[model samples]
Every structure is written in structure tokens, then in C-alpha cells.
Target: MVTGGAGFIGANLVRALGEVPQVSEVVIVDDLSTGLLDNLDGLPARLFQGSVLDPDLLDDALAGAASVVHLGALGSVPRSIDQPLQSHHANATGTLMVLEAARRHGVRQVILSSSSSVYGANPVLPRQEGLRPVPVSPYAVSKLAAEAYAVAYSACYGLPVLPFRFFNVFGPRQAAHHAYAAVLPRFVTAALAGEPLRVHGDGRQTRDFTFVGSVTSVIVDAIVRRVTTTDVVNLAFGARISLLDLIAELEDILSRPLPVVHEPPRPGDVRDSQADCSRLRELFPSVRPVALRSGLEQTVSWMSGHVLTGH
Candidate 1:
């Protein structure tokens, strides 16, 4: 069972899971609040259209499922800052509900989609799992709380859970027009249209931008291998790039300079973030890191098509 299966990452993951020979069925549970039906086009999966907050709906979705991937959440730092209660309800309470349903359904494993935001503004270069979390936003707090619940469920209820902390993931199918859209998609869309790209805080903030394919590959591997552990692993390339450098790379891909507009950094925004992927390598020794430039090229190609088609 895949929560948020029609979302950006979830939709990509659903496609990846279809290639697994051992997998028989894929169940998708999404409320369409942030997920789009177009993202699930041509996908073979049982769709359960409802929020995870609905216990009855979740129970129905969990029926006949072997494992659960909890990716559904109200994701966005600025949005979470604007609506703290809704973020907590969706990210924190919704995760607890999923775990409870998984436990009730006798699911063998539950994989959680966590975030690097839990590290907050700590000056740590590459964040490790051992560092104390200093969450700065409601979104971070909700993810941290969800991670705690996952660990507790594993220890107290014997439920096998593995939480993966993903860095700035970007790739095809990511929404480009949403108010809370990620930086890559927004920049790609603007650049394709010959519009000025908005840069917050001088565009010097650094992030360990990860590709979506890498994220889904690790997820499918975990599900197919049935990894049994309560460890939290960082899934990233471990390479940090400033926003200015990212823009330069995009310009190089497009063969044209993009106009830039500087703006003040929004609240709850962190300065720099990078992941210590040693634990991830230790857990999944076979996984290979995808280069940022390669991922950007693929993303730009897809975005160009989308722009031509007016999607």
C-alpha cells in the first residue's frame, strides 16, 4: 500500500514498483488534496480516494496489503508556517493513524518518508542521525513527531519500520505552478517561459538537491528486499549546491541566461542543508548516486515538453 501514491514522489514510486517482479498488486490511498489524477495516468493500481485521517477508508485500503509506504502529508515549510494546525493534523496525526492501521492489518513492514528539515538551523555541515533535532517549523515538528511514532511502533508494538529522510528531491511530474512548489520545478518553468526566476535571500542558500529517481529506487529496493530495521537513513547525493550555482547549471542546460529577482528569505527557511549518507550507504550498498547535472537535464527535457503541451 502506498499513501500519497498519486503525488510527485509517490507517483514515481508507484511506477518503479510496477517493475518489481515479486510485487503482485499496488494500492494507492490519496485524498487528491495535493495529488493529481493526471499523475496516476496509465498506472495499474487500486485507488482509494480519501484522506488517511479516515480510519475506515485507511482500513479498507490496507486490506490485502503486505507492506505500507507512508508518504502522504501536507508538505511545505511556508504552508506549514501559515497553517500549523492543519500541518500537524496531516503530517503528525495522519502518520500515527497509518501505523495503527498497518498494525491492525498485520502488515509486515512500514516505510516512512521523512525530511531533512528536522535538522533545523543547526550549523552541522552534513547532518547525521545522532544529532539532536531542532525543528524550526511546524512541518519539521510534524515530521519529527511522525519519526518518533514510527520508532515507538517498532520498539513497543514489534512493527518493522524504516524511515528515510529525503533531501531536496526534484524531477519530472513535480508541480511547477503551485504556491508551495519546490525550487527546481519553479525555476525550470520560469526559465522555459523566459520569465524571471525568483531568488530568495540572495540565492546563496545551499541544499543537497536529490533526484526523484534515486529516491524511488531506494524505496523499491527496500520494499522488494523487505528490509527489517528501525533505522533512519538519509537518502541523498551528499553533494551540496548553492541556488546561484543551480541557476547557472539550468542556464547551461537551456543555453540562455535566466532573469533573476531577489527577495527576502521567508520565515522558517534554513540557510544550508546537507545529509550524511554514510548510514544510507551502509544500509543499501548497491545503490548508486545520481549526478545533479544529469537529473537537471532530464528534468529540463520533460519540462520543455510540458511547456509545449501547456500542461
Candidate 2:
């Protein structure tokens, strides 16, 4: 079972699971808040339409499930800044409710998606899970609380939970129409529309952007192998790219130069982020992440057909 299965990563994972021989059934629970039903259209996964905070719905969803991947969170640093309470309730509290339900159901594995943003204000180069998190924003605090709850559940009740600190994950189906859309998707959409790509702060801020396919492959492999770890895992390879570099690659893929617009840096934003993936590599040795350029090309193709830019 997957929570937030109607969203970008969740939908991709659901599609990937359809191909596996070991998987007999796939179930997803999501409230259609940000996750569009269109994302799951024609997919072979069963849907339970509700929020993870709904304990009754969670009770129903967790029944007879082999495992649950928790990805249903209110994501956005700036939004969380404005609505910290809502973010906390939906992310931190919602995760607690899911963990409780999974525990009651005796689920085999509880794989939770946390964020690298939890490492906020730490000023650590190449974030490791062991480094103490110094969260600056309310969103980071909420995610930290969520992951901490997962880890605590693992220790206290012996729940098999693997918490993942994901870097900037991007690929097809990632939404870019919103004001808080991810950098890659936003850049792609603007470029497609012949609009200047908005660069937050300088174009020098770096991130380790993992493709969604690589992430899904790891999750599918974990389910197949019944992999469980008490430790938090970093979910991106070590390659770091600045925003300017990302634009350069996008320009190469499109075979055209794109204009740029500089914007003031938003509050509670990190300077840089990269994941130290030694632990992830040790866990899933067979997976190779899609190159950023390849992933960007795929994303551009997907977006041109899907999203109507400058409409």
C-alpha cells in the first residue's frame, strides 16, 4: 500500500509496481488535495480516497496490506512558513497516525519519506543521516518530527521502518503550475513557454537532484527483498549541480538558449543541499540513477504534451 499514491512520485511508484512479478496487488490512499485523480487515471492500483490523518480510513486501508509507504505530506517550505500548524498536522501528526495504523495491522515494512530539508541550518556539506539536524523552517521541523516519530516507533514498538531523507527528486508528472513548484519542473515549464527561467537568489545554489525512476526502483527492490533498516538513508547520489548548470543542460537538451530572471531569495531556504549516498549504495547496490540530462529530457517531453504553458 502507498499513501499519497496519486501524487508525482507515488503515481510513478504505482506504475513501476505494476511491472513486478512478485507484486500481486497495489493499493493507494490519498486525499485529492494536491494529488490529482488524473495522475492515477487508468492505473491498476486500488484507491482509498482520504487523508492519512483519518484514522478510520487508515484502519480500512491498512487491513490485509503487506506494507505501507508513507509519502502523504503537505510539502512546501514557504507554505509551511505561512501555515505551520496545518503543515505540522498533515505531515508530522499524519505520519504518527499512519505509523499507529501500520503497527496495529502488523505491517511488515513501513517505509517513510522524509526530506533533506530536515538538515536545514546545519551548514553541513553533503548531508549524512548521522549529522544532527538544525531545522530552520517550520516545514523542516515538521518533517523532522515525522521522521523522528518513525524512528521512535521502530525502537519502541519494534516496527520495521526505514526513514529516507530525499534530496531534490524530480522527473515526469512532477507538478509545476503551483507557486511552490520544484525548481526543475518550474524551469522546464517556463523554458517550454519561452519565458525567462526564474532563478531564486543567485543561480549558484546547488542541489543533488535524483530522478524519480531511480527512487522508485529502490523502493520496488526494497519491497521485493523485504529490506528494512532502522537507520535513516540518503536517497540521492553524490552529484551536485548548480541552478545555472542545470539551465545550461536544459538549453543543450532544447538546442536553444533560454532567458533568465533573478528573484530575491525566499525565507527559510537552504543555501545548498547534497546527499551522501554511501549508505544507500550499500543497501541497494544494483540501482543506477538516471543522469540529470536524460531525466530532464524525459521531463521536457512529458511536460510539453501534458502541461499547457503560457496558456
Candidate 3:
């Protein structure tokens, strides 16, 4: 079962999981709040259109399910700042409900998607799982609370759960039209339209952007092998690059220069983010890392055909 399966990363993961030979059926539970049902079009997966916070809804969805990938959460730091309680209810409380449901249903595996934003305000280079989380935003705090519940559940009960701390994950199906869109999708949209890529800060903030394909691949592998741990793992290779460098790379890929406009940094934004992937390597040594340029190419190709086609 995949929560938020109609969402950006969730949609990509649902498609990948559907393709696997070992997986027989895919069940998805999403409230269509942040997720778009169109993203799941033509995919061979069952959809339960409701939030994970509802016990009856979650119970009905998790019946006889082998695994649950909890990806349903309210995203965006600024949005969380504006609506802190809503974010906490959807993200933090929602995760607890999912965990409880998984435990009740006897689900063999549960993969929770936590965020790197939990490391906000921490000045540690190449963020490790051990770093003290000093969350700056309501979203970050909610994610921390979510992951903490997952960890606590695993410790209290012998529940097989892996709470992964995701870095800047991006690729196909990622929303670009929204006001709170990720930088890569936003940049791609602007560049394709011959508009200036509006950047926050001086455009030197670095991030370890992991492709959605790689993330799904690892997740599928984990589900197949029933890989579980009490600790959280960072899900990114050490491919950190600044926003300016990313723009330059995008220009190279498109074979045309793109314009840029600088804006003051927004509240609850991090300066730089990089992952310490040693733990990830230890867990999934067989998984190959996707290069940034190649990932960008895939994203551009998908966006060119899908997002750029029509209204």
C-alpha cells in the first residue's frame, strides 16, 4: 500500500512498483488534497481516496497488505509557516495513524518518508543520521515528530519499519505549476517558456538532489527483500551542487542559455544541504547512483512531453 500514491514522488513510485514482477497488487490511499488523480492515470493500482488520519479509512486500505510506503504529508516550509496546525495534523498525526494501522494489519514492512528539512538550522556538512535536528519551520518540526513516532513505534513494538530521511528528491510527475514547487521543476518550467528562472537568495544554495527513479528503485528493492531498521537513513548520493551550477547544467542540457532573476531568501529556507550516503550504501550496496545530469535529462524529457503539452 502507498499513501499519497497520486502525488509527485508517490505517482512515480506507484508506476515503478507496478512494473516489478514480484509485486502482484498495488494499493494507494490518498485524499486528493495535495495529490492529483490524473497522475495515476493508466497505472494498474487500486486507489483509496481519503486521508491516512481516518482510522476506518486506513484500516479498510491496509487489509491483508504486505507493505505500506507512507508518503502522504503536507509539504512546503512557507505553507507550513502560514498554516502550522494544519501541517502538523496532516503530517505528524497522520504518520502516527498510519503506523498504528500497519501494526494492526500485521503489515510486514513500512517505509516512511521523512525529510532532510528535519536538519534545519544545523550547520553540519554532509548531514548524517546522527546529527541533532534543529527544525526551523513548522513543516520540519512536523516531519521530525512523524519520524520520531515511527522510531518510537519500532522500538516499542517489533514493527519492521525504515524511516528514510529524504534529501531534495525530484523527477517526472513533480508539480511545476504550484506556487510552492521545488526549484528544479520551477526552473525547468521557466526555461522552457523563455522566462527568467526566479531564484531565492544569491542562487548559491547547494542541495543533494536525488532522482525519483533512484528513490523508487531502492524502495522497491527494500520491499522485495523486506529490509527494515530502527534507525533512519539518508537517501542521496553526495552529488551536491549550487543552484547557479544547476542552472548552468540545465542550459547545457537544453543547448540554450536561460535567464535568471534573484529574490530575497524566503523564511525557513536552508543555506545548503548534502547527504552522508555511507549508511545508505551499507543498506543498499547493490543500488546504483543516478547522475545529476542524466536525472535532469529524464526530467526535461518527461516535462517536455507531459507538463508542457497542454493545460
Best by lDDT: 3
| Candidate 2, 88-161: lDDT as tens digits | 99999999999999999999999999999999988888898899999989999999999999989999999999
What TM-score should be assigned to candidate 1?
A: 0.98
lDDT at residue 41 of model 2 (Cα atoms) = 84
After superposing candidate 2, which stretches have Cα over 4 Å from the reference? 309-311
For model 1, the superposed segments whose C-alpha errors exceed 4 Å read: none
Give the TM-scores of the predictions, in the order they appear: 0.98, 0.98, 0.98
RMSD of each: 0.9, 1.3, 0.9
Error of 1 at 10 (Å): 0.4
Give candidate 2's TM-score. Answer: 0.98
Give, for candidate 3, the lowest lDDT window spanning 10 residues: 302-311
The 0-to-1 C-alpha lDDT of every candidate, in the order given, reads 0.92, 0.91, 0.93
